[model samples]
Structures are given as structure tokens and as C-alpha cells.
Target: MSSQFELLTTRRFLPFFLTQALGAFNDNIFKNSLMLLMAFTAASNLPMSTDILMNLAAGLFILPFFLFSASAGELADNMEKSRIIRWVKLAEILLMSFAAIAFYYELYMVLLGLLFLMGTQSAFFGPVKYAILPSLVNEEELIGANALVEMGTFVAILLGTIGAGLLMGLEQTLFAVSCVLVGTSIAGYLSARKVPAVPMENEAKPYKWQPVRQTKQAMRICFEQRPIYLSILAISWFWFLGAGYLTQFPNFAKNSLGGDSSVVTVLLCAFTIGVAVGSMLCERLSGHKIELGIVPIGSIGLTVFGIDLYFATPANVGDQILAAGAFFEQAYAWRVLIDLSLIGIFGGFFIVPLYALLQQRAKPQERARVISANNIFNALFMVGSAFSGIVLLGVMELSIPEYFLVLAVFNAVVAVYVYSQMPEFVLRFVIWMLGHSMYRVTHEDLNNIPDEGAALIVCNHVSYVDAMLLAGACRRPIRFVMDEGIFKNPALGWLFKLAKTIPICAKAKNEETFENAFKQIKAELDDGNVVCIFPEGKLTRSGDINPFKKGVERILEETPVPVVPMAIQGLWGSFFSHHGSGIFKSGKRFWSKVKIVASEPVAATSANAEMLQDKVQQLRGEYQ
Candidate 1:
């Protein structure tokens, strides 16, 4: 129930948040203002067509990210970030001065150049901004921190876009932009001054200046960690999809919806607001962890809503400008707006975790380079998006709505591929669903589980889903030892396999399998991972804890790992549990409250199965 906004009150998070938001706001103001200027005022005087100019502006802005992100990443990794951020903000102020001169002189070419310069500044700032989060906030605060940052970013983008449009037609438009840009840059610089110093992991490392060499080096560093590599890919794909959506908004509004420029604002506002809402909700939904389950859910919504938007397109949109109010009058317009909003909402769900995951998992020394690699891919994806749009809409002659349909199907394919490559994503989705939908799960004394080192976790099994739920509750990865029969069940066999749940058979039923299970448990423990087992060796059939089995003693005799007793409560009557006639045949309980509580670890030398069961029993309380 704690507010993610509380982070804004803290010294570690607030300054960086303001600096990042201000930079994003300034970038959008310049970018959006130029786009507006070229389309309306400068088109007649310019040699290039408005379309070409607009696309050129966008490409120019993103080009530096491709060329310099790797170098930026290297710099961030080798030097202190607070210093880097301050310099970047100062560079922004200088660039805005040039932008002001260019705008005042009506020098379109100079303005375009300044746009790329702004992009270069952002490219250098990107890696340090993201890579600093892990050092600034504790693990428990990461999701909340990311949520606030992501939300602040979108809100800034929204405001910047709106501000650009409002100021473009004003009497001293260039003067106003000059003042605003310089003001935000100064504000951002002031914030950077307050950013707490985050030490560089590698201060002696030499910076690489060659773009190709640095990019290849960064890629090499990224590939050294599989999860980080995949997360970067997923994040890049999001940018690709986002670029497609955002770039098409103007045409979709004007041509497809037969509306004026104002309608585009309405559509964008809906999407931006939706993303803000979804980003803020992540902290609450994730229970303050880097929950990957929300990624799949977000991707699903993005694809579904994207497809629906194609269908939601009004069939008879005529060549007439509709006011914002009028645009919402049509039923399908409402549907279209809703689809856009949901897509943005799901987008937030998809993106925040990937960034958090990359930060949490990447090597400390190379984290900024990993983020730099991410930015490089993001640029590539955005460029690829432009090409894809051209091919689909130009060569194929697909309507904007039809392009949305194509992109939607492509999103589903990309998601399936990513999830297939990383089963952890899908498994987390299952756990998240079980925790959020099937039950209102709560954790108590979860911190009792050691952050690292081997621990033997013994829990009273209450349902077929208990292991999955427990995996979700505990912060560290748990190696659960489940009955072999349940492991082979067709409904959940593959899931259990993906989860790497250890399957154990009774010694009487299969001595070899049971012995092998013990060996695997010891191996996992030796690897310093948590190994969990049901002390009763099976789920309680009567909603009560069964007598503890002797297997716990045998395992302890070999490994002597710390034994942590945990209790699963309020799952006895759930569909997965042996409730009433049997399991899986009865109506399911929705949002049932389930509690998983862990007792402090007991020394393996003195702990016994019976005593651990008593601890679990007491933790279970009235539920069992």
C-alpha cells in the first residue's frame, strides 16, 4: 500500500528523476516544435517536401544514439555518473542557445543540425540515467523507482508535446522556445548538481572512441549475460513497436479518421495517459519486485488492442475535420481511443520490468555498457520501424489501420519467440496470475530467507499450485522438490519442467529416483540456491498438515544446510487443493486470500522434521 511517489521525497531518487524528466521535456519541445514549424511555416521556403523534412528530422535525432551510445555507455561505466549528468545538462543548455539562434534566424538547416546535437546529448545521458538506479535504490524499491521514472517520462513527453504546439504560433515563438529550452536545461542542470554521487565500478578503464569497435565490445559484454541480452532485445522491440504507433498517429488521425490536428492530440493524450497509469500500477501489481509476469500480460494487451484498433476504425470517416469532442461522438471512435489507451497501458507493463531486469542482472562493472547496448538496439529498432512502415504503407499500399493489424500480429510472434527462448518470463506470468487471480497472496517473514547461501525450505503443501505461489512470494529462485506423480501430470508437467521443479519418488516406489532427487537437492544447495521440499512429502488431503516424513533428516545428514520452515495457508479450499469430492472438478475460488509465511531458519545440525513441522503448523495457524 506504500506509494511509489514516496521516492520523490528521498534524496537518492528525486534529483535524478527531475533531471531525466526535464531532459525528456526539452527534447520533445524542440523535436515537436520543429515538426510543427516545418509542416506549417517553413514548408513553402524549404527545398525538401514537408514529409521528407519531418522524416529527416526524426532520423537525424535518432542517428546519434546509434553512433554514440556505446561510447556513452563506456564513459558512464568508467566515470562518476553525477558528473556526467551535470555535463550533459550543461551541453543541453549550450545546444539550446544554438537552437535559439537558428530559430530566430529562420535557418531550417541549422535547426535540423541542432536537433541532431540534442539527440547526441541524450544518447550520452541515456546509459548513466538507467544504470544509476540499482546503485541509488535498494532492491525492494527498484520497481517503485522504475515506475515513477517511467511515469514521469511520459507525463513530461505529454506536456512537452502540448507546449510545443501551443507555442509554435505565438508572437515570439522562437524567443519563447529559447527561454523555455534554456529554462528546462538550467533546471535539469540544477537537479544534476543534487544527484548523489554514484561511484564508477571501473575507473581505470580506457574509453573507446570508435563507434563500431565500442558497439562490438558492448555487444560482447551484453552477450556474456543471456538474460540481459534478451531483455535488451525485448526493450528494443518495444521501441520499434512504439515508433510505429507514434509515427503513424498524425496520418491515422488526418487520413484514416478524417480529423484535424487536434484529433491527433486527443488520441496521443489517451495513449500517454494510459501509459502513465500502467507505469504507476506496476509497483502495486509487482508487489515491489522486478516481476516479469507483467511483461507477457502487457504484450498480450498490446497485440490484442492493436488488432482491435484496426477493426475499430470508423468505416465512413469522411474528409472533414472533427473537433476533439466530435471525434469521440462515434461509437467506434470511443473503441479506437480505448484501444490506443490499452496499448499504452500494456506498453508500460512490458517496458519497466525489462529495464529493471537489465539493471539488476547485468555485471556492475559493465552495467552502463549493457544499457548502452540497449540504447543502440533501441535506435536500430526505431529506424527499422520507419522502413517497415514505408514498405507496408508505400509498397504494399496498406492503410494505416491495416498496418496496425500487421504490427499487432508481428508483436504476437516476437513475444512468442522471446518467451520461448526464456521460459522464465512465461513461468513468472503463471506465478503472477496464480497470485493475482486465483488468490490474494500475502507474505510474512519472507525476509527470513537468506538473500544468498544454501537453505533447506520445508513447507506444508496445501495445493498443486503451492510451489508456484511460493516461488512468486520468495525473492530468490527456489528449487522445489515435488512428488514425481504431480510432476508428470499433463496439465502442469511442462510448467514444472520450466520451473525446474525437482521430482522425487518415494524410496519404496522408486529408490533410484528418490536417491537421484537427493543428489540434485545437494547439488543445488552446493550451488548456493534454496532447495524447498514439503516435509509431509505430499499435499494434505484433509486440509490439515500431515505427519512429517523422515526425508528431511536424510537430506540434512548430507548437506546440513539451514532449514527454513514455511507455511501455506488458506489454499486448502482452492481448486488445486483436495477440496470436497476432489481437485480440478469443482468451481474455482476467485481472489481467495492465501498466505505464505516463513519462520526464521533453524540450524541443520539441531533441526528435525517433527520440530520444523511444528513451526510450520504454528505459522499456518487456523488455516490448517
Candidate 2:
């Protein structure tokens, strides 16, 4: 009865959450444990080159997420999510058993096979893990829930990585790792079994014979939604940037800062903490929406901080050992931590929104398939990033910091390109910059209206700028019923169209215009949308709410749902409106203060335009 976030405290979320955390923990535990040991522990006896084998292991693990993820998505969709998760966790048990045997027998290929199988288990689990959230939580709590999950995942990495290091460094490493995986897998399986059944996303999608074919078909379906597809691309780019950043850390510690093991720890901890901190703050910062402002902000930070790290690198060369205390004794150590933490914060800001956005916005029928497509792209990008490392570091004569600078540029370039193609992200970016950089704007009585379902919002027709102001204030999208004259205005028409504005005209000017407008309005309202109509029918020239029109009654006549009364105060005298008309009009276009206010909703069927006018007047009592 309360809301979705309330249930997050229940056993359902915690158990599943622990299962996920433990799985991720065990994964990084085994993978990094093996990699570190292969590189340093058995350097003299290993058959393959240290770097080559380590890189190969990394590639093999990521490969299945690409090749098998689509099939995994289908399996998740067709089978029960909780049931699928159980099998995935159970598979981890067997896989880890094989891993311990491989390590004990000194069979690197067998060890590598276990890693690939672990990847497969994760691949199958990935779609169900994310896709199940929406079914479990209410829409309103999704942002906060996602934030918690994201924060949990990052924190798990922090602990998992350190745990793996400690285990691998032990004398009985294989036994220790095997024990952890077995225990964690059993716990994961138990928690997974407790999760409520979440069925397939699209029961209609054919259960084909071959996974490759299923994967391709799912990929095609995912690409159909432009915004969803954009999210996938953005996610892929994040992987590219993240992989590049994470890959360079050890090298950065060894070469740029002239430090060894402890330095690597400091760098890793700073980055992990940064992302963890940033991710937790996203729910508050984004107003519990899958805000893309953070994405652009994070990208900018990724570029700036990344370039800064290059210049700030200590003018020393080669590796030197330093204990934990000795490393932080240097002033330069804090700089690296600060740089890495900010990078992580921005990374949290960037990645979390895209993931939550993809989950929330994806078509219910094909959500898993869409997520599978996401996994496919992420795998491809990560592999590409590894190859890119070889090319940049191996072929090119660039230093580690230089490689980082190149990645920063790539982050900025790709971000700008993608955001430009999909202006919503840019729109959110602009609004975010405006509200954050400028003064604070508060909303009163915003919850007076329903979160979903049809609602008719009535507001003062302040100026051409009213829609933009309201759009920024609210999380939900609104279809503004603007005058046809304003709609055709060359300057603002495109903006309105981009916003999917509905243009209405007087019956005298063109009967067809009103006809089409009402049809669209009726359809949007029927679809349970928020439609804002200025009953004054035109911008106020008298510095007050103009006479009401019958459009309000007409809309209610068609689809009577909820009539939400709203207003924009302190903007009537601003630049966008004709404050005093003629020569008194201020031409100032930027840096203007504006405010939008909303009042409680009225009953739609009993509401009249005159009553709605009074509601607007009451809300907009004050001015700039």
C-alpha cells in the first residue's frame, strides 16, 4: 500500500541482492585470483606468456556474454526468472569445483574453461537479474531501487576484488577459492529460490533451436526502438571507457607514479569508492528518474579528469615498491585518489541511468532480448577495448597516461555524437546544467496529481517559454496544447515539434486544425498521458490570467479522468513574456529567472473552464 521502495526492505530484495552480490563477488574472486597468480605466482613455470595468457583469459570470459547472451535472454524470458537464477547459481558450484581441480592439477586450460563456464552462468543470469526489478518494485521506486542495486554491485566488486587478492595470496589459494565459491553458490541458489516468479518478457518470441539464430533475432527486435538502441550504444561506450580506465590502473601505478602493489590498491579503492559514492547519490540528484544529465556530466568528467591525470602524473619513471602507509605519504597519492574517485563518481552518474532507463523504457514483450542486445554490445566493446589496448600500448609509442588521454577524447567524441542524434539526453543535460548551476527551483503540490493515468493539467499561459519551464519541473512528459500561431512560429515551432506538442486553432481560422488537434489530444489522454492546456487560449497580454475557453470542458467531455491545476509564477514580467509590451520588451534571452508551480488536481467531469481559471489565478498570485 505504501510504495515500491518500501518493499525493498523486505526479505525478497535482500536475499536476491545477497545472492547477486555473492555471485559477482565469487566471479571476480576467481577471475582476478587466477590472473594475478598466473602473472606473478607461477611466472617461471607457466607455458604461455604471462600477458598473453592473462589477456586470453580475459577475452574468453567476456566472449560468452556476447555469443550466448541472446539465448540467455530467451531462456530468462521463457522460463521463470527465479528458477533460471537458481540453475545459474547451481552451475557456478560445478564450475568452481572444476576451477579448484584445474588449479590443483596445474591445468591452465581447464582453469580457463571454468572461467568461460562461469561467464556463461552470468550471461544467462544477467537478463533475469535486471529485468525482474520492474516486476518486483513499483514504477516510482525504480530509480531508488536501481541505485541501491547498482551501489551494491560496485561495492561487491570492491570487496570481491580485495577478497580475491587475499585468497590468492594465501598458501592454500585453490582450496580457499573453491570453498568460497561453493558456499556463495549455495547461498545464491537459496536466495534465488526465494525470489518471486517473474515470467518471460515476451512469451510470443519463438523458442528457436539455435542460440545464435535466437540471438540475432532478439538483436533485431531490440534495435527497433530508437531510444532503447541509443541506450545500448551509450552503455557500450561506457564499457569501452571503463575497460580502458580499469586496464590502465596497474600500468599507471607502476610507470606514472613510480609505485607498485600498494599504489595499485590505492588506485583501485579510490575508483571503486568514487563510483559507489556517485551511484548512491544518483537517486537524490536525479529526482528518482533515469536522468541522462548525469550521463553527459559523467562523460565530461571522464574527459577532463582523464586528461588532468595525465598532466598531474608525477614526473618520475619505472616501478618502485611502497607499502600502504608509504604510498599515501606522498602528496601525489591523494591527487591520484581524488582523480580516480571523481572518475568513479561520474562513471556511476553515467552508467546507472542508462541501465535503469533501458530497463524501464524497454517494451515489456522484448525487455530481456533488449537487455541481451545490451550484453552483446557490451561484450563486443570490452573485447574491442582489450585489442585497442594492444594497439595503443603495443603498436603505438604512447605512455600509459597518453593512452588514457586518448580514451578521454574518445569518450567525449562518442558521447557528443550519440547525444546529438538523440536530443533527449542533450535536453536533460541542458536542464541539469541550468538547475544545478543556477538557483534552486522547488515544486509544491506536485504529488497532487497521479503519477500515471490520464490527467488534464491547466496552467497560466505565460509565454512561449511556459512549456520548457514546466517540462524541466516535472519528470513525466507533457503534451502541450499550444496555439497554432505559436506552433507555426519559425523560432519556437521546431522546439514544440521536438517536444511532440499538440497545436490547436480557433474554429474560425481552420476547422480541420481543431479537429485534428482534438483527435490527437483525445488519443493522448486515452493513452493515460499528461496533457497541459492553457485555457486562456493564448499568451496573456494583460499580465494576468486571460478569459477561459471551453477547451477544458471539451477535453473532459471526451475523456474525463483527472484535471490537474497548475501555474507558472514570477515569469509574467520575464523576457519571454511581453511584460510591458512594445519598447518595454526586454530582449534578454539567457540568464533569466523563472518559476513554475502546480496546484492540486480537480475532478474532471465536474470541472469548468471558469473554475480552472480561478485555480490558475490562485497559484500564479505572485510575479517576478
Clashes of each: 0, 2
Task: List the candidate 1 regions with Cα displacement exceeding 4 Å.
Answer: 206-208, 584-591
Off by over 4 Å in 2: 1-8, 199-209, 318-324, 437-439, 444-454, 483-497, 503-523, 526-528, 541-543, 554-562, 569-605, 618-624
Model 1 TM-score? 0.96
List, residue by residue over 340-388, the lDDT tens digit for candidate 2: 8998898888888888898888877667778888999998898899889
lDDT score, candidate 2: 0.80
lDDT of each: 0.90, 0.80
| True lDDT of residue 46, candidate 1 | 93
Cα lDDT tens digits, model 1, 1-624, are: 278888899998899999999999999999999898999888898988998888889989999999999999988989988889999999998998888888888899889999999999999999999999998998989988988888989999999999999998799998898889888899999999999997768866665578888889999998888888889999999999988998899999988897888899998899999988899889888988999999999999999999999999976777678878888786778889889999999999999988899988998999999999999989999999999999999999999999999999999999999999999999999999988887888889999999889999999988888889999998899999999998998999999999999999889999999999999999999899999999788877788899999999989999998989999888877888877775555565644798889888999999997898899899999875
Cα RMSD, each candidate: 1.8, 3.6
